[model samples]
Target chain A: MTYYNIDFSLLDKTIKNFRIKPQKILLQFPDGLLGSPLQSVVNFLIERDIEPVLSADPSYGACDLPLNQAKMMGIDHIFHFGHSTFAFPPPSEFKGKISYFPVKVNIEFSWNKILEEIIILGWKTVGLLTTIQHVDKYKFENETINNSNITFVQHKEGQILGCNQDRATKIASSVDGFLVIAGGDFHASPIVVATNRPTLRYDPFNETFKLFDEQFRNKYLSKRYALIEKAKKATNWGVILSAKSGQFPKDKGSRILNMLKRKGLTAIPFIMHNVNLPHLSNFETIDAWIITLCPRLATDDYIRIKKPILTSRELAVVLGDLSWDQFITPKTGEHLLTIEEFE
Target chain B: MTYYNIDFSLLDKTIKNFRIKPQKILLQFPDGLLGSPLQSVVNFLIERDIEPVLSADPSYGACDLPLNQAKMMGIDHIFHFGHSTFAFPPPSEFKGKISYFPVKVNIEFSWNKILEEIIILGWKTVGLLTTIQHVDKYKFENETINNSNITFVQHKEGQILGCNQDRATKIASSVDGFLVIAGGDFHASPIVVATNRPTLRYDPFNETFKLFDEQFRNKYLSKRYALIEKAKKATNWGVILSAKSGQFPKDKGSRILNMLKRKGLTAIPFIMHNVNLPHLSNFETIDAWIITLCPRLATDDYIRIKKPILTSRELAVVLGDLSWDQFITPKTGEHLLTIEEFE
Candidate 1:
């Protein structure tokens, strides 16, 4: 990555010319010790400044730097941002002061939300994880794990969470399956299976925990379930699907109409307009309406569909749960499936 | 929040009197457009730059900004570093040229690694998600999601992923849950749940996906469930846990030892370094041993014990589909119990 930096190259060269003498130079460090942090030190010395030079580095947690190389480059003193990652040894010549930045962790993820969701997931056992950058914070999370049915297996030593495969494999053998959670590219699931253990990748990115199941979600839910529930309620189903000015469903209100007619329930599929269904439009007659949700007027208009309305995906979800061959037959066209005469 | 700016307040008096009557000027953006992109423009006019000005705004995605103020502020030309959220109407009088700089998306997470672990999760249904910062890459992932039983659902309107509660809730109801692969605080879990969906967050700090169940990981991924199938076979009957470090179990490590012990095996527990095996010198007599599993030393050191060693958490998975009460006697230690213990 070509970092757009405040170019200090010109200033460094000016000092390197040795034309000006320096006393106590105020050397600034824009970036930290990830790469080179000896610029200002070298600049100060070239200008005849004394050895007590000051600079800083960011050590968010633990930091690994080229200290010997920095010393060789004529560095003197240092101030650090973030927490201390290394123990600075005292030089043979105890010279200048070294400062430390307190390690303060921002509330990036709320545990309260996690705990609440855990209750919702009915998760009896939880997989706990974090980044290696925050090792101390990882330990702090242990207590929180104690309050929940959380299994706190930590992935340590590597820059990312799953670098150590053997470690996670051993962990997988212990839990029901592993809950793999982490920030950035450091989730712990890839490594958890190294031990031939089953794992659930708990993605903290969207605050949801789902077990790894290779089978499609078709079995867990269905569209007919909504229709079934609505039918049993003995109510009229009002399906308001989207057919905008330029875009229209290829089926053009055909598939859903056939299915409802076969099921012996009255259904309508069309665009939402003011003149269509006015006045005493009792929603009791409508059982379940499948709405082809569109981006153009979705949030603005679709929210008004009082009766249970299904989006295209939601309709698909219901179709998936039932045996596809039984309800809908595959057909060749812009549309893939046709409602089988509901038989 | 403490911006290390040049503290231009010191130069305000001098800058106020120095006015540049320019036909066009370039204004660079800092902190992206999450902040006001007009800061530089306002400052320039305040500094007395009294003619038509050209400014560059590196704003991106569907994020909209006030351009009328700019036009009123005497903007005759514009150069943007990144994509614009809205179509720019051509300047009425100046007929200035408007340009764009496409901000390329950077993949911090390795897709190969993400794919490998998902296969292990063995789930038939999965939800895909990303942060607003990475919405651009969602199209490329469409093919990847298609390869498996995955459903990619993003907040279609206004691609900003995190920090928007209404959108998150909308998304939560739309899909089962989401697999969020993200970088920085932008993809944190609580932020993900703002959508009211169950989310699995992948850390993007590293170039590859590292499972979070190892003791060596940097992030605290205690909510993840990962199993490790190692090269070595375990022969231990049971394991023990400890609080000598004053740290509670992170869910994954909470209960492997007891499960093995319940299946007619011996499970032992000890304080830190407090174990004194009777057959310390015996090679084959010792069965498998289990512990909290912070394997600081390598397998080379533990070869003398010569038995199948395991963790308390690992044994639980082997005894899957069993009663929790049969293994662990729920104690009243501050140890929390999450879905990990039950699920």
Candidate 2:
């Protein structure tokens, strides 16, 4: 019942202070955390006399908000769990309706292990990146490491989002390598390919520093290069676009379509709620698909796609951008970067 | 490549007279028609120097339009195939942007077979209902059947849409039975149960006249009654609402929520783009789900849905309007009918 370690006091105080009597409220949780524990959360809300409706839609990241659903059902409030705030501004009307409750995982491992790994790897200064879960802990824990030889450079936000890693990319130049202070390969693996810097994960739960170095990068680079080569020969490209508020890269699809046209390739853009393979199979004419949606989907979801499915950055190679080779890793979070800006 | 039997000249003439210079257009076809033949249609548009973007999303019925996508990509026109005009009015902005091109399936069967079947069944008067494809032909052909005792009642619109059979329902009282001159069971099967009248189909391609009598209606009634029985015992119900233009039953979700509340049952509304099992599984507290979507899905898609899922009509039985027994058929095109109006 106490699994999420959510601040019940904070939630209660916020609801009391907002003064909006919610007849119905929606609770959204990421796919990983939508389990038995959520029932307890539902009971917690019910005990307070608030009717809670769980959003069954896929919550990939903070960017994929249930704002449209909230507005549709006239839900007074939405508690989005397991993620932090997105960089972009929410709709004006959604100001007080959304409340983010990020799950913070306390690092149970020794902090000295990261420093020992960095010294052994011969990296002088390493960029420290973690997910929202351990961002605060990593910031506080960084001060305890007094090794002058192995400096840890921290970004302004001090964390990385799965779909967006602009914070780490911004401070990539100031560090020799990147050390992700979190569990799992979800956030760490993508940063390695995106920044094209030496990246290693300091898993607190496992208490191990796993390297996602040259070997891992080369495997992904080869796969991306293969897709690029295939796309270069493709005459017709299906540009996939999403209409979901957060995932709608507003003008990105049009820009990609125009870019393809300039290369003398025939391309058409398709707008979808969620891109499913069964629906995409209807496009027999499209030899390849360029996903102008979440950058992670191109790698994470489409590894087995029969036809060559490339992300926006991967399409840059076909667009005659030779320097994009540095960021050849799939599912790399560079949604904002254009073909010309890939370094 | 000359498939689809589309009137190319008619299409050409319509485009010329519309006076809109469309550089890019969208082409949407039913899932069944999205095959090799569509390539010829694409070539037909491309030959006319009109760029065509094929919509790959699943087209359930005429109601599910890609308006959001059409607007997002700035598509000049949308050529929807295999369907005719919707019963409900389109949005004001879509007045000139959309066009319907229904696919006419030529009747290879003799017209006498229908009359022979009606005479054999001893029906004196029958209501005639054809799909958009055969509307014009049926209107002309109805004049040929001259029987003093057997009368053919024609509706004002002369056809019925798959998602709506209100036109036929309006004139059901004057006829002994309804004859749907459509190819498939999509339209005819639902009308049989909705009107609680004898319904028969004279399929054009198959050259057959089949009746969906009490036996067929009874089977559907049993299934729907079971769902209603299950929903009656459900303490927590998840009422799903959709925001997709056509799918969004504007205020129907809230109305249903309020109705459920009035019955002293605890229910919450969940607005979604489309209901999927993975998303619906997150709602552990909800024992049953009420789908306020295309009425067809509660019967067609949710057969395998683990938790008992009930349509609005089915939910009505649980809500105390016991007359839902009259409209026990699944996929009935009765969006406007409340439980009380069934009788």
Q: Pick the candidate with the highest lDDT.
A: 2
List the candidates' TM-scores in order.
Answer: 0.22, 0.77
Residue A326: error of model 2 in Å? 5.7
Q: Any runs in candidate 1 off by more than 4 Å, and if so which? A: A1-343, B1-22, B25-73, B77-80, B83-102, B106-109, B116-124, B131-133, B140-144, B155-158, B161-167, B203-205, B208-343
What docking tier does model 2 reach? acceptable
Highest TM-score scorer: 2
Q: Write the per-residue lDDT of candidate 1 for residues A1-343, one digit (tens) a residue.
A: 2221223454345445544333323222323322233333333343453432222221112232213213322334333333333343422222333333322333345566666655655556544444433444444445565676655554443223222243343344345444455543334433332333344544444556554432322322243344434434533334453212112232534565555546655443323211122211232334455544232122123335454554343344344444434332222211111111122
lDDT of 2 by residue, B1-343 (tens): 1234677777887688767778878888887676665777788887889888767778777777877667655678888888877756434334446788887655544667777788888888788888776776754445447643578887685587665677677777777888888777887887766676789898887677778887887788788778777878898778887656667775667778887888888776666676775567666667898877766667656665777887776776777875653444333445323322321
DockQ of 1: 0.01
Per prediction, the TM-score for chain B is: 0.36, 0.84
Q: Per-residue lDDT of A1-343 in model 2, one digit per residue for the tens? A: 1244566776777678767677667888876566655666677787888888767778777878776666555678888887776767444335446778887654454766767787888998888888776666654444547644677788785677776677777777678899887778888887766677889888777687789886887788787777778878899788887767667664677788888888888777777777786567666777899887666667776655678887777777777865553444334335323222332
Best by DockQ: 2
